[model samples]
Target: MLLRTERQPSAKRSSGRDTTEKPTRGADVMGKGSVLIFEQDKIVRDVVSSTLARAGLEVHPAAELDAALQAFESGKLDAVILGAASAGDGASELIHAASRVSLEVIVLSSSPTIEEAVAFVKAGASDYLAHPARSPELLGRIERILERRRAREDLRSTRQENLKRHGVASLIGSSPAMQRVLNLVDCITDNHDATVLILGESGTGKDLIAKMIHWSGPRAEGPYMNVTCTTLRDTLLESELFGHERGAFTDAKTQKKGLVELADGGTLFLDEIGDMSLAIQSRLLRFLEERAFRRVGGQADLRVNVRVIAATNRNLEEMVARGEFREDLYFRLNVIPIVMPPLRSRKGDVPLLVRHFMNVFHRELHKPVLEIEPALMGQLEAYNWPGNVRELRNLVERAMVLSTTEVLWSVVRRRSRPEAPSEASFRLPPGGVDFDVLEKDLLSQALEAARGHQARAGELLGLNRDQVRYRMLKYGLNSPAPARGGLALRV
Candidate 1:
């Protein structure tokens, strides 16, 4: 007959077994997720419970089926370990019950067999462990399960945060041109499979719109991958988009999954798609048409569900006319077209954007809030922002960094009289100059003038920081390290 004893403070078991063994290293790091042990054998149940309890798990041990089910239903559990002998005929039923609630279940059997393991696994058991379960193995499996649960929780939390951060409400514009873009986004947020093409000049927030669609849409929980087509050449870009098998090329050492495969059930934002070579364009078109693609060296046509969103500052229609871009691919991507209005065209929104960015910079830089000068606001609104919203944002950040008082008087006074150079300022040489050399020389001089500050260098030219960096990289010009105790401005 079994005798039940009251729970003790020490590691002494009611089954007369000593469970006072020291827990292995890293055992206490098993996290706070709870585990349920359902075992009929009093000795096994007591031992397993003690092991897990020592490992820092909130373990609930039960000798009866009814008691186990009661505890499982009453509390939240990350995993449930069942003894096959104790469960007997009800093993499958219990597995189904736990699985229905999405709980991880592991079956423990004394006389293990492939048939029984397969049956239990088919019945929704996460794993099967042989009898006399070793403490290390048991704890290792439980730790892995808890680790996966934690990762999934983290992903869910991130998805919720992205939804909040990139939602339609964060778009921050109500002008008629922006209203039209918002309406299009609202209509397509529910359509997860449609291809979207965003067209706008550089720095017009095309990337922002793509993110808004992904984070606010039905597939918000899935991954969002952004690839700049201009950054890679044809062969490299092809392998990047379609993956490659081992020995596919000189540098192909191991099998790799591409962005398209990793972005399965999600969105893949291809920026600067106009720069993609014809070879890559052909492959991309085929994937769009068939929803399947072969890896660089693999013969299998793997399929994935990915929403392609292509954005470019260049005019694809003109490129098609010039045979620079594929007409078929352009049509496929332009199914749901979105044209972002230039910031100059929406000059009425300048005041709103200025104030919004000022607040954003205030919080980011931890600076005291400064009142916007009326004259500065007038100058900003009247000026043509060739670099669009990005330039405006950079200007605000720069001004905030340079401000010393509660008012933006000094920066406003300096900005009021803009000294923009005209086209006539640059004279063409009698012998036409090498454009690349001229560009590199100008970039070098600007960097020197700004004291190696990329953003300030960009301000000297009409380019944004990213454009400056890209050109600098193209010209193999490395920026100098920032000096200590220098003003830290946003890039």
Candidate 2:
């Protein structure tokens, strides 16, 4: 009975029903919702209440603003329909009160002009409906508003869940070393603009640590951009960092913004920072000091708010001592230094890491690997992982991808080591041997263990291939051994 009943025009009584429109059922217009009606006119109030009740909504009718506010507070009202004629001077006040509690307010007017309707909307009215409106129009508007509110709530919940998964829980380790790292991260997670320096060897998950800090901080909603300093040349890297004006150079056809500008109010991660040239280091230092930078070929200085997180596997102290890295930049970037321990140092957490990766790849590959062979697991834990967590993850993925068995047993094994003798089984020579000779012997033994592959040999010795090659050249081992993949190893 939403539409007005049409029989004949009544000159004596006002029914507040539209005679031209046909009656429509409220149930077909919208779903059930809670509504509060505030109106002083008896006929108008009854009409609205009846329409809403027939529409399957929980309806509450109030004669004055005070009673309306009481009902609004008592019931879980999704919306409020106020008659401006009866609301009179307190119409705006009622609208504001409903808004404070996040309740949607709709205003009904007898003769609302365009400006009056606009004013009501500006005063926090969700919608303004003129008198003599159809019941379907009112119910549809309320349905749409409730639908949008539900959508926003659902989206917010999804974002919070994602933040929890990637921000803190992704670190994943119970070892003492990992616990210390987590404690450090937790302390500074709220400091959005603090510079964080992550120190670790390659593949030690420095990038992961940087992400954890950024995503857990206040700037989590902002942009995050990661750049590898060593991957770009000096000139290109400069333009990429500080942007460039149009006609600045041969390739500068149009003005471009840099990572700093793009990452405003968020974080900019500079990986392999030890490889950055001295010139870029000077520019970076100025930005850190002043929070401003001039684009290439541009005279204007642009200011930006950004958090700088730097990571590197190289030894910065040694580079500073050699005058290759700026000492001032080193101290500035190291405001909060977090050291990521290599995987070999935390052997006790190997099994946990293994299971974590197994679950990850199993989901990705859609394959079930429910168990691990004890022998293979023992070998994995015993091996000294040079590439750290990255290497271990790759090893697990490799085994899972290639094996067809329900239980994983195949493993990538490193060269076997000769058994070490007990302390009592060996006697020191009368004249102690030179430390250099022993070091050289160990280097040669590692080379033999790797079967003359410099890369694998370096992994065994905890050094890179370049360092191993330099050592071989110094020891006068010039004969090249046969190797695959264009690798020439000194025999």
* Most lDDT-accurate candidate: 1
What residue pairs clash in candidate 1, if any at all? none
On TM-score, the leading prediction is: 1
Whole-model lDDT, candidate 2?
0.79
> What lDDT does the true structure give each of the candidates?
0.83, 0.79
- Residue 393's lDDT in candidate 1: 85
Q: Please, what are the lDDT tens digits per residue for candidate 2 over residues 151-267? A: 766756855765776677888788999999999999999988789999998878898888888778887767788898977899999999999999999999999999988989888
For candidate 2, the clash count comes to 0
lDDT of 1 by residue, 156-239 (tens): 899888887788887878799999999999999999999999999888999999999999898888889999998888899999
Give the residue spans of candidate 1 off by over 4 A: 1-19, 25-27, 40-43, 63-75, 85-93, 218-222, 243-257, 296-300, 404-491
